[model samples]
Target: MTIPLVRVHGVDDVRLDNIDKPRTAPGDVLIEVLLCGICGSDLGYIGMGGLGMTHPMPLGHELVGSVAEVGERVSHLQIGDRVVVNPMAGGNSIGNGGTEGAFSPYLLVRNVAADERAVIKIPDGLSVDQAAMVEPLSVALHGCRQGNAKAGDKVVIFGAGPIGLCVALCLNYLGVERLVIVDQSSHRLAAAESIGAVPFKAGSNNLGEFLIQQHGQSELMGMPVPSSDIYIEATGAKPVFEQIMNTAKTGARVVVLGLHKQSVPLDLANVLLRELNIVGSMAYSDEFPAVIEMLTGGKIDLQPIISHRFPLSQFSEAIAQASEPDEAIKVLIDCQC
Candidate 1:
C-alpha cells in the first residue's frame, strides 16, 4: 500500500509523493503520524539540497503519533499506544535521511528494545500537539543543561525563534528569575514578552549596554561588561556570536544551540582573556522525559510559542510559513489532516 509522504528531491525541491508504506520488521513498530513540527534546519536542508544523500531524503524529525502496529519482538510498545520517538537513537531513525519520515501518514520505527527507550509513550492527558513538542523541547532542555543554568542567574538568549523561546521556558522552569530574549523580529519579540522574557530588539541599541541594564554590570579585563551568567546562541548568525564574545561577562558560559552552516571566525585571545566557556549543544541527550514532565505538569505553556499549523497535504504552505522567521515560530504540520 502507498501513502502520501513528503520527500526532498533536491535543492529547492520538495513534494508530496505517494510511497509504499513500510512493512514492520520483527523488532519494528509502525506509527500513524499525528503531527510533525518543522525545524529551522529543515529550511537549511531545503536550501542545501537533501542531507547529502544520493536519493531523495525524507524530511521531519519532531513528531508524535499512535502506534499502528507492534512487532512481535517489541515487548515495550503495544498497538494503539500514543508515542513520540527519538530520531537520533537506534537504527530506526525517521527523517534525517532515513527511509521513512514523520511527514507522512505512517512511520516505521525499527529496532525497539527495553534499554534503548527510543519510542517514548505519551502519558494520558497530554494532547497530541504537546506530545509532538517533545523533540524540540528536549533540544531546548539540553541547551539549558549545557549552559548549567541555575536559579537566580541572569540569562540572555539570542534569537526568539522556537528554540530560543523554548530555552526561555526551560530557563524559567529551572528558576532563572532574570531572563532576556533578543530577536530582530518585533512579532517574535512580542511572543517573548508574552512568556515573561525581557524582549530586546536585536539592533535597537547597544546589546552590551542593554544587557548591563537588565543584568547589572561587572568588570572584564578592567572594562565594564554585562554581568549575565549565561548566554544561549540560537540565531546561528555570525554577528550575534561576535556580539556575545565581545560583551559577555567574565566566567560566563555561552551555549550554542543553533546550526551554523559556515565556520565563523573566533577570537581565541578574547575568549582566553575573558575566561569564557563556549559549548555546543546538538540534538538532545536524555532531556525528552524532563520536557514531557514539564509539559504534563503544566509548568510551561507551549500555546503561545506555536504560530502556525498546516495539514500534511499543505506541507509546502507550512514550509513557506516557517521560512518567514519574522512572522512564524514553531510551525507544525498536522499529519493526520
Candidate 2:
C-alpha cells in the first residue's frame, strides 16, 4: 500500500510523497503515525542539511503511532496497539555524535544484531497530540529530576518556549512554590504566565535587579539569598548562561537544558565558593510513563500549544506556518489525508 509520510528530501525541503508502507524487520514493528511534534533539532537539521542527519533520513521523533505489523521476535506488541515511539535509544553511530536514538517516519531500533528498543506503550484517554509531547516533556522532566526539586523550592526557567514552559509546569508538579520564567518573546512569556508562572523578559536592563528585589530574600550566606532554588536554563542562548549565573543566589542549583554551537564563559569560582551545583541534562532516560500520566491528569497545557495543523500534502506550508511570530506551539501533519 502507498504510505503518506513527510520526508526531508533536502535541506529546508520537506516533501510529501507516496512511499511504500513499512513491514516488520527481524525485531521490528511497522507503526502508522498518529501524531508527531516537530522539534528544534528537526528544524535545525532540515535548515542546515546533513549537519545532524543520517543519510536516508526522516525527521520526526516526538510522536504517537500504532502497530501496523510486528516481527516474529517482537512479542510485547501486536498490530493495532497504540504507542509512543522513543526513537532516542542507546547505540553508537556517526550521525548525531554517535547516538542511535532517532526521529523518523518509521523508526527501526536496531539491536546488537540490528535489534530494536524504541517502542513505549501509551495509555488510553491521552490524545495523540499529547503523546507527541512526551519527548519534550521527558526532557523537561529529566532536567527537573536532576534539580531534585523539593517542596517550597523556587525554580527559574529560562526561555518560555515549549521546553521552558514544560519545565515550569513540571516544576509545579514537583511542588515548587515560586516559579519564575524568563523570556523575551511576549507571546511565549504570555504562555508562561497563562500557566500560572510569573514571567519576566530576559535581556532587560532591570531584569536581574527586578527578580532580586522581588524574590531574592532568603539568605544562604548573607549573599542576598536566592530567588530560584533551582535555575533551569532552556533558552540555549549564549548570554543567558551569564544571566543564569548572575541571577542565581548563593548555593543555588542550575540545570542546563539548552543546545547551542558556541561555548560560553563560565564562573567556576561562583560555583565553587558559593556551593552552586551546575549540571547538564541530555535527553531522557525512562520517564515516558509518568509524562503520559501527567497529561492524563491535566497537569500540562498541551492543546493550546498545538496552534497549527496541516495535511501531509501541505508539509511545506506547515513548516512555513510554524516559522511565524505568535505561530504554532506544536504543528501536526495528518498523514492519512
- Name the best candidate (by lDDT): 1
Pairs that clash in candidate 1: none
Worst 10 residues of 1 by lDDT: 109-118
Candidate 1 structure quality by residue, lDDT tens digits, 108-176: 888776434778898998998898889988999999999899999999999999999999999999999
Tens digits of per-residue lDDT, candidate 2, 48-129, equal 7634445434556676888777777777777788887666553523123332222334444443124334676777787788
| Model 1 C-alpha lDDT versus the unseen true structure | 0.89
Residue 203 lDDT (model 2): 63
Q: Report, for every candidate in turn, its global Cα lDDT versus the true structure.
A: 0.89, 0.70
